[model samples]
Target: MIQLKSLQRVNPRDVEAPKKFYVQAVGAGKTDLDRLAYLISNQSTVRKPDCYAVLEALLHNMMDELREGRIIELGNIGNFQIGVSSDAVDTEEEVTSNLVRKAKISFRPAKALRDLLQTVNYKKVS
Candidate 1:
């Protein structure tokens, strides 16, 4: 289930237009690694400690692989790859690592994740 809140927002393309109410998602809370491990443990024979260890190892390995310029794909979860924003240069020789302004990990959700959203139920809140 998801929670939604209504807010008045101006149209960026037409600032002179009157603000209108639009629904946006609001945080319902959060689930951490501990809670996830506990839930996974309950659903299978694996213990919570073991689950936590596996999750931690997954994080470490994923980071190592991503730093090596490899895309990390977790089955139905999604794929993560490093993306960058660089300063434009006039000459090809001027383009170098120094030109990179920022690097960020981008995630592309898998079909399974996108399908899950179709089944979501929402409740409007003030």
Candidate 2:
């Protein structure tokens, strides 16, 4: 069994602030830092210059691909494809119809994230 240090043993300040911000400002409903701290200390969070910047870039790329009517597949994760509704379809059946015009983006979690979630063990609830 792997031994892991509790959040209290690590940078308590950094850990506490974000948890509070998420709960109070973001309205996360409840502030729970135990799991977040575990993942952070274990280096599970994706490393980048800034999380928002990375997300912005990812969204931009996904939107660009969607607009071009192309599916974007993230490794280990799922693919994003633009969706079409029956209401949007034309009555006349036409071969090679350029009906898929609107852009949409979807997300699928990676296998690593899924596996990690499945294997995560929490401390006994008091």
List TM-score per model, in order: 0.91, 0.39
Enumerate residue pairs that collide in model 1: none
Candidate 1 residue-wise lDDT, 8-124, digit = tens: 999999999999999999998899889989999999999999999999899999999999999999999999999999999999989999999999999999999999999999999
Q: Candidate 2: worst 10 consecutive residues by lDDT?
A: 19-28
Best by TM-score: 1
Cα lDDT, all candidates: 0.95, 0.55
Candidate 2 positional error at 50, Å:
3.1
Report the number of the highest-lDDT candidate. Answer: 1
**lDDT value, residue 9 of candidate 1:** 98
Tens digit of per-residue lDDT, candidate 2, span 27-84 = 2244334444444546746543344455567878878988898988888876778766
- Clashes in predicted model 2: 0
Candidate 1 TM-score to native? 0.91
